[model samples]
Target: MATMPRLLFLVPVLVGLAAPPALAQSEPFRVVNRTTAPALALHAVRSGRGDWGGNLLNRGPLAPGAFFALRPSEGAGCSFDLRLVLQDGQEIVRRNTDICTDRTVVMTLSGAARPVVPAPDGKPTPLPAPAAATARPGVAPGARPNPQARASTGTGFVVGPDQVLTNHHVVEGCSRIFVRAADGRTLPVPQAPASDARRDLALVRAPGNPGPALAFRANPVRRGESVVTYGFPLAGLLSSGPTLTTGEVSALSGLADNQTQFQISAPVQQGNSGGPLLDRQGNVVGVIVSKLNAARIAQRTGDIPQNVNFAVKGTEALDFLRRNGVQPVLRESPGEERSAAEVGEQVHPSTVFIRCER
Candidate 1:
């Protein structure tokens, strides 16, 4: 028989995601299914490599709320990509999963719905576009609200000498705008900011020379292409440094065919509003904007939305910069792909945390 691509198993629905309990090296990894449907099969392959292992479940179906332990290979890396098959024939694919770090793979309904095949080379495999969901009548679309009630924070990146770019709402109605670099140097915006409320982008100038400018890709971003972003989301709750998230271009347009934005699957929080969304080659492609209001959507549809986030397209941002007399840099062509961590290292110097004081 042909070698199975990887270990096969399944997890059921999990309501909320939390850090899993760590197990000793000798212990096996656990998978918890809390989904509505029974998991038919589960398979996994080491991220960035292609090879199959024996079934983690020993060829048994994973029922809802059921748990199982998967022993690790004798000498394998920590991260792996997962593929879970449900009884309804729908599947889910999650990439760069660190089984040891997470410990338990608690599957959610919406998270386990998107079916994708893992590419052997770590590239995104193309899938047909999913049909847009119709909203309930009279339910308004509220993009995740900016939490700038008193003093709020967001993220920005350097595009030109002494110039930083972020969302308009981040600095809107603020008495002061301050930025903190990765090295813990905090500086205030000295000059008036160039604002474009229509596009939800703002360019501010702070003291000191920037390390290096981030470049936008010359070519357009394709749907299903892998993307990464760096930002300081959830300012006080999370780390003082930038956090990185990776996903794929889920759609070419934002909600309701808004061409100015791109829908991405990379998770973003409130403070991510103005972060840079980069392609696999470390080129700017979009500005982290807003995520669909899951609470509102869940209230209306009874199903929670997952990773339904939006970003301002880099083309529009570049245009905004030029219209305001700032020349944004652009890469000549596409290059070899690199890991998200490598891209974040180069982006660290350009990205900063912005605090808006009203």
Candidate 2:
């Protein structure tokens, strides 16, 4: 799983200012869907109240290039909350409202908002290289098995000695989970109590292994900091033990749920969830949760930005694990945690290529 880079615009300043003293002026704007598909039954929701006050039902599906004007009542001008809600119950809320006058509120319904092309500098930037097979101190290397022979492979991390972290959906209904270490060892994951699905996380204990204590960091990460993600994507078609992807923190606290989480530009695929999102200092900052997919919105005729991935904040996960009585083997200091490049160098042999039957 590699991190993808994304470009986002800052909310206009006028959207956040206090309304004029006079009650005669009201905010005005337009809503537009700029994707290839139409947005079904879109509605504007007022912020804070969780209610839709405007009743401009898009009679026909809003085609890719179609837009509708939103006007405020006469003699009533103030900052108003607005959002786009689809018939399928998906919603995209705007954090700011700058409706001082007529404006073209163009919305991108599908596909990723275009990335900012880097300036053409001849200097070569180091792209993340593929994982190489190298043994870490005290950890042995493992062999690679045929990927096609496996039924399914789920990505996870060693949270404690002989303990792993993953998503319940990744191992749901499985009688046993195969645990692969970075040193090329494979062990069975024993049944462990799982947390509620509202958080979408799970924990498993490695079988018969008192492995090394894992490292953790609790500091909140600021947006635009360098981040590296590690996971087995596509069931190991990519390297088996922690494929590393690099990107920056795109956003924080912008999700629909308004939860404090990281919006990383990491390139992830199916089987990449439950992996660690590490900061530049090699400390775990968050857990990879979901990848942004534009095709799904296309199918539903709804608008959503693509390449937007979400992570569960590490602090939240740590709290959840503590509340659930799952104790992680935490390292004492920064010197104890291995760097991403160092971990990448030594983790190949300890991981196994998992193949499962459907």
Candidate 3:
């Protein structure tokens, strides 16, 4: 019997962080297909804003190893999210990504290509394939894969048993959403409570029992205090578990002096949205939201800034939960600090992987 060709979803590891070329700045951003397989459709959108801008490659398929430029609307900023559907029906998505920073994104596909065939009705019919297969192959037959595939990923943490807190943008427009615990158990989330889109926070109930709920910090966050973030960035594609990065509270206000957020120096990636921003004592201070656009900033001031990321202030989340009639556990900041490793262990159980499907 002939084995089926393994479908590959090749997304650039750091395409979101790619620095746009300054000298040859053309359209704000564009995509280059470096993969061997044809991209059936491509869609781009401004992060945290509107719908998938529509197919940039027109109504036709993008040939293998071809590229095209994106024409975003007038107000579409440098930060964008992308979705590319392959000929095999497998989709590769990068969310809340900064494409304007990098003028060109050269996408690549791995493994063999399965050509989509035209049906008897004259419509193109893509070959049936696994939507997402990020887990490592081989093991006992029918054994659960370590890291399962997801349509799109975001970061969320346990606030109450069967209750998770995340950005509304993370789960917005999701027909189906699920939460994957640090232990690798996938829990379905059918619906979300009323969300505060202005503040970008939402709370959803988990279908299964969850780990220890994370505690929030009551007092205000100060500038220059050490902080850390934990979440699943790139999920099965990068690491099989949650990732951690450390930094300090760069500022008390968000972009444009927004009082509902904070500026941090910790590095954040596409999947880091909605993850917990914990202080040194492991208390939740904020939710990872977004980062600055290096390309846009460079266009404004002939210099490229680094490590300027933003998070929704924990107090905002508190108010939203209170409005929803759910009282979250709150704790005062600890006088003494714990080691980074200790903090990670204490909070890792409560951190979870959030997936959205439509």
Best by lDDT: 1
Off by over 4 Å in 1: 1-149, 333-335
Candidate 2 backbone overlaps, count: 29
lDDT tens digits, residue span 1-358, model 3: 1111211121111122211222321244556666656787776655554556446655577776666665554435445667677765555555555443456665655432334576799645557544332222222322332333225678888888788988766775454567788888877664544566678787878757767889999888889999999987775568868889999999999887989989999988778888999998999999998778766677768898889888989988888888877788999996798887888998999998877653
- Ordering by TM-score: 3, 1, 2
TM-score of 2: 0.51
- Deviation (Å) of 311 in candidate 1: 0.3
Q: Rate the local accuracy (lDDT) of all candidates.
A: 0.71, 0.52, 0.70
Give me candidate 3's TM-score against the actual structure.
0.62
lDDT of 3: 0.70
* Candidate achieving higher TM-score, 1 or 3: 3
lDDT of 1 by residue, 1-358 (tens): 1122333332212111111123443235666666777776676666545544444445568888886666655434445666666776566555555564456776665633664455799533436524332111121122222354346678889999888999876765455667777677777676557877667888888776544678888897889989998998877778877899999999999987989999989998878878999998888999988788676567658999899888999999999999888898888545578989889998989998887654
Greater-TM-score candidate between 2 and 3: 3
lDDT of 1: 0.71
Lowest-scoring 10 consecutive residues by lDDT in candidate 1? 11-20
Measured against the true structure, the TM-scores of the candidates, in listed sequence, are 0.58, 0.51, 0.62
For model 1, name the residue pairs that clash. 5-52, 6-52, 8-42, 9-42, 12-33, 12-34, 12-35, 13-34, 13-35
